[model samples]
Target chain A: MIELRDVHKAFGSNRVLRGVNLTIPGGTSMVIIGGSGTGKSVALKSILGLVKPDSGTILLDGEDVAKAERDAFLARFGMLFQGGALFDSLTVWQNVAFRLLRGSLKRPIEEARAIAVEKLRRVGLKPEVADLFPAELSGGMQKRVGLARAIAAEPEIIFFDEPTTGLDPIMAGVINELIREIVTEMGATAMTITHDMSSVRAIADHVAMLHDGVIQWTGPVADMDASGDPYLDQFIHGRAEGPIEAVR
Target chain B: MIALAPLAAVGRSTLAMLGTIGSVALYAAITLGHILRPPFYIREFFSALLTIGYFSLPVVGLTTLFTGGALALQIFSGGARFNAESVVPQIVAIGIVRELGPVLTGLMVAGRVSAAIAAEIATMKVTEQLDALVTLSTNPIKYLTVPRVLAATIALPFLAAVGDIIGIMGGYLVGVTRLDFNAAVYLRNTVDFLETADVVSGLVKAAVFGFIVALMGCYHGMNSGRGAQGVGRATTNAVVSSSILILASNYLLTELFF
Candidate 1:
């Protein structure tokens, strides 16, 4: 289980996260939804200790993320960045096998390459795509490569950041299904942050809505439509006006 | 009141400059600190050496060569006023060994390597590749900055040596073919008049210039703002700052050595 208790983060006078508290049970998918710059990613990154919360505790399976050993702690988590974050200089397979070929998880080159190829196939990329660079791939393919690299090490926890942001609706749907299938099969805990309503419906088992630097609503995905919170209603329905300010 | 406004503007600019300088110094110190620590990335280091040192050979060599040749021509013409054109070989040797080789090599590499490093790193930051690196259990500075900085530091002296030698050869060609100096006499004058200290000081200047170039690149790149404009600004700043620093430090190093 991952728990964020009364998390607070501020950049200068701009209070990005005032007091955010949330929790996710083991092996479940929790998607946080919010508008632009409302601190959704900040809240998620806070859990990973990537953006440190000014004051609060982020506990992953009982221990504080800040207190745990960094490399060992990080090895348990995989992240798919919004932009795909694929290393442009390296080939697709090298990017996928990066973790296996270095640091504590070092493996023989051939073994690592084989695993990378398998992961690429797992993500629906062809074996031939392995030799190509990130620039050579399309946006959707790059996202798939990023996804492959994220799960390459078969980590215990996975974080997805705006995974469907830039893709066409069709490609986004494809990615959503793949994410759902992979997360379910891996049984790894997942915490995703996206504003894609379709993605919420497709990939989330539970949902949290962030607004005004706090979780305005969070519950099982089933209850989200009828949650009756004006803020959540305004957000989920794509309405521009509610308790939340539109332009802040 | 108008006078006060101008004064306030000057104060703001001064403070901003100082702040930037302080941050760069801190960054350099952090890079130095990381370089001394363990868990070094050997592959990244060698790759940096190849890119910064080996690949830079042609640009450095060619720039120094042309400058040396031009200097020979100018010096020969100027010395002709006194009928002392025989000073060509000695002046070319000293000038190439003492100043032009290191400074020109530094400036050329600053334009090439600094911009490339900044663009590559700023692009990494823009795409969140650096953040991904962090998540992958790698320190971006240790993985990126230290190797490049170390390679530049180690590589520049060798580059400067090569540039100095090639630059002398360029002057030799010019002196023999264009200046009508006896080839044997020119070679003898160059060999007899040159001192080891002059060559060593220039190489030292090159080393310092290399450190400045790579540091400016890493510093601006890492601190770059978001988007294409941000990365573009970082690249420009890297080249500009590295060039300025190389020239300024070259003077200081020369003063100390001389």
Candidate 2:
């Protein structure tokens, strides 16, 4: 289980997170949705320790994330960054197998390559694409490769940041379905940050809406539609007019 | 009337400069600390050597050659006033070995290697590749900066030695062809006048300059701001700062050697 208690983070004077309290049980998916600049990404990053919280305790499996040994802690978690963040200099397979080829997870070259190829297959990428660099691939293909990389290590916890951004509706739907299938099949604790309503419907088991740097409402994906909170309703229906000021 | 504003601006600028220096210094210490650590990537080190040293040879050689030839001509012309034109070969040798070769090579590498390193790393940051590396449990400093620093430090002395030889040859060519000096006499004077210390000191300066070049490049690249504008500024800053540091350090190195 993962738990965040009164998490507060500020970048200079712009407070991005304010006393964010949340919990995600093991073996489930939790997707955080919010408008631009609402700090959805910051909340995810705070959990991953990419962005340090100004004041809070992030507990992963009952141990504080900040106090954990870095490599050892990171080894159990996988992350797909917003841009895919694929290494341009490395080929697709090399990027996928990066974790296995170095540090404590070191494996033989052929074995690591085989695992990378398998993960690529899992993400719907052809074996031929393995040797091609990230720059040569389309944005959607890059995202698939990033997904392949994220699951390559079979990490216990996985985080996806804006996974469905910059793709067509059809492609976005496909990615959303893939994320749901993989997260479910792996039985991993998944935390995804996205504002794509389609993505939320397709992938989220539990949903949380963030507004004004706080969790405005969090409940089962089914309850999201009937939530009485005006902020949550405005975000859910994509309305420009609501209690959450559109201009701000 | 606005004395306070100017004073505050000066204070802020000074603080910013100090912050930069402190960060660079701390980063340098961390990079050095990683030098002997395990999980060493030999491939990266070899590739860095090729990029920082082997690829840099032609530019270093050509720059020193032209400068040496020009220096010979200038020294010969200046010596003509005192009927001391025989000093061409000796002065050329000292000028190349003691200062010009290392300084020129340092500036050229700063332009080539430093800018490339900064731009590449900054682009990596812009694209979020550095963040990915962190997820993969790889320290960017170890994977990126250390290899280049090691390669440049090891490669530069050899480059300086090669540059010094080429520079002397350039002067030799100028003395024999352009001026009416005896070829054997010019060669003999250049060979005899140059001390072992002169050549060694230049090579030492080259190593230090090489370290500075790679260090500044990695520093600016790691701290670059967002977007193309940010990467461009980092690249420009890397080259400018590395060049200035090279020139400044060259003077200090020369003063010590002399």
Candidate 3:
């Protein structure tokens, strides 16, 4: 289980996260929905210890992960960055099997490459694609490669930052299905941040709406349409006319 | 009032630059501290050697060769003014081994390797790859910086030594062919003038300059700000700082040893 209690973050006078609280139980997928600059990324980064919050307790399985031995704490989780930030210098297989080829978890080069291929296949990528560099791949291919890398170690917890952002609608749906299948099949606890409603519906077991630096509303997918909070409503429908101000 | 305005501008700019330098120093210290802690990545060491040393040979070699040739010409012409042209080979060998070989090679590698490491890491920072590494139970410093530092430290001195040999050969080519000096005499003077301390001192400078280059690259890259402009600035800062530090430290080392 992941638990965040009364988190606060501020950069000078600009407060990004203000007294936020959240919890995601084990064996479930929780998605946070928020517009750009609404602190969803900051909240996620705080959990990953990328952006240290001014004050907060990020607990993982009852241990405060924010202050935990970072490498050991991080060993249990995998992440898919928004941009599919594969190492430009490495081949696709190398990127996927990066963790397995180094440090305490290293395998033989051939073995690591084979496992990378298997993981690539799991993400619907061909074995031939393994030798290609990230620059040679299309956006959708890169996303799939990113997915393959994220699950390469079969981490217990996974974070997906805008998993389906730049893909075409068809590719996006495919990715959503892939994420859903992976999360369910692995029985891993997952947290995804996205503004894509279709993705939230496809992948989230629970949806939390972040607005004004706090969670405005949160519930099951069924309760989403009737969230009743105008901010949540405004975000879901992506309506121009609402309580939320539309930036020019 | 006008004089004071210029002075105030200079003062403010100096303070800002100092502040920037201080932050880089602080970041480098923290990174070094982290390196001494656990979770060292040995694989990255080989990778950095491949990146900083193996990949940098051609450029360093060429720079040293040309610099040696140029130095020979200038020294020969100056020596001729006092009927001292026979000093060419000895002066060239000493000059290259004592100062130019290490300093020029360091500056060249700094220009090539530091910018590359900084730009790559800065791009990783902007693209969230570094964050992904952190999430994967990897200390980015161990995975990234330590390896480069170790590789450069081990590899750069060897490279500098090679540059020293090639640089002397360059002077030999010019001295024997262009300056009408006997080959045997030029070789003897070159050998006679170069002491062990000179070469060792150059190698030591290479080691320090290598650390500075990698440290500056990793520091700026790790602390890079958001977006393209931030990365651009970091790349520029890494190259410029590494070069300046190389030259400055070279002078200090020269003064200390000589």
Candidate 1: give its CA RMSD in angstroms.
1.6
The superposed Cα distance between candidate 1 and the true structure at residue A117, in angstroms, equals: 1.1
| CAPRI tier of model 3 | medium
Candidate 2 backbone clash number: 0
Worst 10 residues of 1 chain B by lDDT: B35-44
lDDT of each: 0.93, 0.92, 0.89
TM-scores for every predicted model: 0.96, 0.98, 0.94
User: What lDDT tens digits, residue by residue, belong to model 2 across residues B1-258?
Assistant: 587999999999999999988988999999999999977978889999999999999998999888889989999999999999999999999999988888888889999999999999999999888888988889899999999999988888888888999999998899899998899999999898988998899999999999999999999999999999999999999999999999999989888988
TM-score of chain A of each: 0.98, 0.99, 0.98
Q: lDDT, candidate 2, residue A167?
A: 93
- Which candidate comes out best when scored by lDDT? 1
lDDT of 1: 0.93
Q: Candidate 2: global Cα-lDDT?
A: 0.92
Per-residue accuracy of model 1 over B76-122 as CA lDDT, tens digit each: 99999999888999999999999999998899999999999999999
Q: Residue B40 deviation, candidate 1, in Å?
A: 2.6
